[model samples]
Target: MKKGSATVAQLSEFDEIIDVRSPAEFADDHIPGAVNMPVLDDAQRARVGTIYKQVSPFEARRIGGALVAENLARHLHAHFQDKPKHWRPLVYCWRGGQRSGAFVTWLRMVGWDACQLEGGYKNFRRMVIDALAQQPATLDFRIIGGATGSAKTRILEALAAAGAQVLDLEGLASHKGSVLGALPGVAQPTQKKFETALHAVLSRFSPDRPVYVEAESRKIGRVHLPTELMEAMRGSPCFAIDASREARIEFLLRDYAYLGDDVADLQRKLGCLNRIISNETLARWQDYAAVHDLPALFTELVDQHYDPLYKRSQNSNYVRFGDAIHVSTDDLSPSGIIAIADAILAKTPVRADAR
Candidate 1:
């Protein structure tokens, strides 16, 4: 009904969230569901800042205010013209600063129920950091360990389908966790965005039941796992998925078939390991790509590279590696993956009252 402020914890009480920061600032990270309604777009914000520093703060405000007014008018005419009078929106900017303040003031002027986020995106970011630091410690984590192509991600999916709680790190990171793990054309989120998503998922689970997650390195791609989450994962008990070399190669070929679309890109990604792999071997792998023999390429990559790296990391990083319950599977077909998931759920007995 009137202009006011809501803390980060109260964000969900609103009907819509509007971010009035510049495009670049919004792209970097904002509240998870916020829609960008920048009062001053990137170029305008830059122009205003330059004037503020070199000319005068008063001049800058005058120019920025005009720009904000014009942009806000355009947004309301194009975007909010159809909104009902009762529509409630939470608006925010870099620190509940002038950009967001201006937007909220005008929205309230129109008699729509609008409010500003107190401390803005910075407040929400601090909440994510604080939650990640303490939440993982309260839950029991079960790490899913395996060599590359072991279908650990698929197995986690099946586990979730079977009603077990899972924390899908790769899913959140939009990565597959290997040298060639990047999904085609899908960019990973900013580290803050990843952390915010992680905190959101973590907050939804009950602490009494064990949370299952794939065993991953400290960094998933460009995003580094929060220190507490990484440490908790390393210290958790593990359940290893053991698949044979042939099965792994077959599974990897089927799962990563998208690589076939761009052999050159595949070769380039594989070439990242030139220092670790002998040139002759790398050349042979590239040759396999040239001939369109993907199974051969995957075989060498798994048996020689991924397997050894996984063995070393799993044994060293996860302290409970020796005690892990190993689930042996002959293949990674649909049925085979389901069987593995069933075996894992059997091994991980849950109390009836556990979440």
Candidate 2:
């Protein structure tokens, strides 16, 4: 790993990295693959921000600087003190400002090889947005879409495992693109980071290979897909993943087990629907959900919201991924999915190039 100031290009060699920005700022956006390890907790950051606004930038820096130093020492002694010798860390704060610089300085003093990112997360975000907005001429895609419980992602994974050139969009995205899509106890990468992650995956696969992705809107939670990729996806051909409502409900429940009695999170994810569904109706649904009315809730959501959107998007963007292989509830198992994929593969040429 390279030591000292780390340029953005140089930072790419690492398999992973740490983000020192406040989690709130990070939740808004951050570098993909960078895990949050905030130097200052939320309260401390708020306190510092207040100081900066009310007092002077100088006073805020003086006070915040001391606090940061203490946090760094604690971090080193506790986490990095006895780890690998001279480890290189890609350090960053918002806009590559004082916070990351402070952390990198402390790392060097402790005999570690620390490289701070130039222009920090902001520059990285710009890079992702630029790449996404103006994707090179060669990029191409094939979208995988089905109703809410169609297991499109599992099929994509199976295809990848089977030596097909594939792009696991959800994996890179840290989202499943639904009310229950978020992984348990893990935060999502920033929107720009998500685009970067998508770009990284897309760049690796041959443009001629039918890159498979789920049909997703421009936004995943707070993150937005890059315009280029979104356009690519919209135009990309698709294989319709079909499944019975019963099977879909089971799959969706298992996938969303993490929410575990947190109906509020579900409502929040549902967004505008909460406004549409009367409180009494919601309470009834929640009660049903509590009593294993999962299929009903899932079916209602698909019928009411997901299905309508999917149909509209598919009807409008049918030109991109031109083929459709419908999957069934009987195809829920791994072999079943593979069979469907193989059946689709058999009908089409292997190296079907896209634009």
Index of the highest-lDDT prediction: 1
Write down the TM-score of every candidate: 0.96, 0.73
Candidate 1 Cα outliers beyond 4 Å, as residue runs: 1-3, 351-355
- lDDT of each model, Cα atoms only? 0.90, 0.71
| Residue pairs of candidate 2 with colliding backbone atoms | 235-320, 236-320, 236-321, 237-320, 237-321, 237-322, 238-321
Candidate 2: where is the Cα deviation over 4 Å? 1-4, 13-18, 26-41, 83-87, 106-113, 134-137, 170-193, 242-312, 320-330
What local lDDT score does residue 203 receive in model 1, on the 0 to 100 scale?
94
TM-score of model 2 vs. true structure: 0.73
RMSD of each: 2.3, 4.7
Error of 1 at 32 (Å): 1.5
lDDT of 2 at 143: 68
Q: After superposition, how far is residue 29 of candidate 1 from its true place, in Å?
A: 1.1
